[model samples]
Target chain A: MPTISFDGQEITFEPGQTIIEAAMASDLYIPHLCWHPDFPPHGSCKLCSVKVNGRICSACTFPAAEGQEVVSSSEEVRQLRLRLTQMLFVEGNHFCPSCEKSGQCELQAMGYYLGMTDNHYPHFFPVRDIDASHPHVLLDRDRCIFCELCVRASRADGKNVFELAGRGIHTRLVVDSPSGKLGDSNLDVNDRAAHICPVGAIVVKETAFRIPIGQRKYDRRTIAEVSVAEEAPLLRKRYEQKED
Target chain B: MSKKKIRIATTSLAGCFGCHMSFMDIDERLLDLAEIADFDRSPLSDIKHCEQCDIGIVEGGVCNAENVEVLREFRNHCKILVAIGACAINGGIPALRNRCDLGDCLEEAFLTGIGVTDPKVPGDPELPLLLDKVHPVHEVVKIDYSLPGCPPSADTIWAALTALIEGNAPQLPYELIHYD
Candidate 1:
């Protein structure tokens, strides 16, 4: 194990741990969109951009090295993080009130965490499709942030049912079927990829409002609160295995 | 003598009046709000015309010509106009109709819906004409502020109104600033 410096604090990490993983292992929360624990880092969303050795890089993909200095909470980095989150908001039709995932969406909670009061960027309002072809899943194309979480999850889980198609600005989520529909795809309700969507883009149909507002995730406590709550156990284990 | 309480006006356009209900959710706090502000041209007050109020709180989207007219009148009268709730800030649920053709939507509801008997589109000169698309209030007129919630919690309404009454920007806590 080697130690890396994150935001002026020393943190220990195993070999080959990304800065984000190391930070997470030590209970440090970094704002992220595409990075998920269940899948490999795709680094699509740059919301986790951090200053590594004074050079900006995505913490989720950048490897943590011994004595490496990582900065995530500086004034410049904070502004960039805010702008990135705002861009995501404007890019999607994230009418939080109308969405079933409102109270629980990590993206929305990120907006709160970053203190984004207004979408400084212009809203794209792209008229995307809401695919209700699946009996269980609702595919709201408008809410898709293009994080490729579904793609990564399906690939990792060996379902290989979802993929991000198109090129550049024309990019969009696609189902792996001739009919181009979720029902035609082999996706089952039990797949980890089925539950990997951070936003309301993909969700279980008929389960809307199952968890009432104010009683939902990120409602009682912020995403940061939940992130830190995962840190205590790791800290205790490290203390027990501490080497003189 | 102290200046008159901040005159406040409110109205519902194409919404379900849920935001107004949330406003009423203030419960006993409504009494406190009354001390610092007076309702004018609001459903609660039942006033017919807006009287150059200090603040105007609008809920819902602009779905018809009548909504546009009412929204313009509010802008003409109030010193500040705030779009409250999701419908006011954005079209919310009603804007889902933007996906459908207006004529086809009308036909589906009146001409070809289930359990329809002798159905007519209810065309009348007195009836407000539908706009081609449902629009958030900002699309029609300027809004001084926006309170983002489905039917913003009662606490949110109270906090926003109190801030407006105190001549400051309405800053809500993250817990209160939900879209749904």
Candidate 2:
């Protein structure tokens, strides 16, 4: 058993476990954009940057090694994560006040966790079309951060309904269909990728703002804190009842 | 050589005084600050305007007419200009309206909505022209440093001040890496 400490709390892992797997088994969550248990880790979003023995590395891809002191809370590491967050915030039209996602949004929670009080960068103001194509969902292109979690989930889960187009900053997630809408695509409502988005960029239609403020996931604590507590038996039972 | 007594000035522009209050929250660190830096024309201290200082901390967004003049004066006077807090950094809450049409907001807030009075826009007055959008300090003038928080925690202010005293780039706190 090799020992690794996450934020100074030591945990032992089997020799071949990735940080995400070890963290999930032990209840620590490394905030990720392109990682899922069932699907292969994409490591595209880079939101999960953590310090491994003083070097910043993505936790989702990093193998947990013996005697490694991983720090997710160092000043330099947190700022780097925040810059990614800021890029995402300004990259999209994140009007928290008007958004139906408001309090329930993971993007908002992460922004709060990262201490993003202002949109410091230039506003892209990229015009985006709203796709009301799905019967139960409203797709807003302006809100997408291009994390590609949706594409992986759809592909891995045998649906193969979603994909990404373009490259670099212009890259975007696309639904596979003639109309290219979720309604037109062969996606089932039960796809895990639809629910696993860290932000409400790809949300279930018409359920935006359904949960009132002070009731969203990670609303009270950082995702790291929430994930740590979620591993406990008592909290796990409580969390299941609230899971969407 | 003895520690050079750095001169400093502070100005509050078109924003709530929260950013200025953040500086005051430095508590006992002000005692150490007095030893290393001399207050030149800070609103919180005896000074009223710039008297040639080493650093200037500008608080608030550029919203009204007087803000531009004051900001320019501070930039011209201080050797280093730092934008303090969310308002100075990114126009804060006021900037939310930057997305909304200004004419619509003015009509709703002043003329047709609650507390209605058709007020004439002042022309030959001391009032500054209102820009269509709120702007961060850096957009108007060059900024040497930016301390961003809603009102950056007192710890951040202290760290930034101490870094300036030591002539080093202050590192951000681990708890606050993403400031807008």
How much lDDT does each candidate structure score?
0.84, 0.73
lDDT of 1 by residue, A145-201 (tens): 899989988887898888888887678999998899999988998887788899999
The first chain of model 1 has a TM-score of 0.92
* Candidate 1 wrongly placed segments (more than 4 Å): A1-17, A51-57, A63-71, A74-83, A95-98, A116-125, A133-136, A205-208, A230-244, B117-128
| Candidate 2's DockQ | 0.13
Q: What is chain B's TM-score across the candidates, in the order shown?
A: 0.97, 0.87
Stretches > 4 Å off in candidate 2: A5-9, A230-244, B1-138, B141-180
Per-residue C-alpha lDDT of model 2 across residues A141-207, encoded as one tens digit per residue: 7678776777877777778777888887777778889888888987766777677665656778767
Model 1: DockQ score: 0.34
**DockQ values, each candidate:** 0.34, 0.13
| Candidate 2 lDDT, B49-99, residue by residue in tens | 788888898998787657888899999999888888867866667766776
Best by lDDT: 1
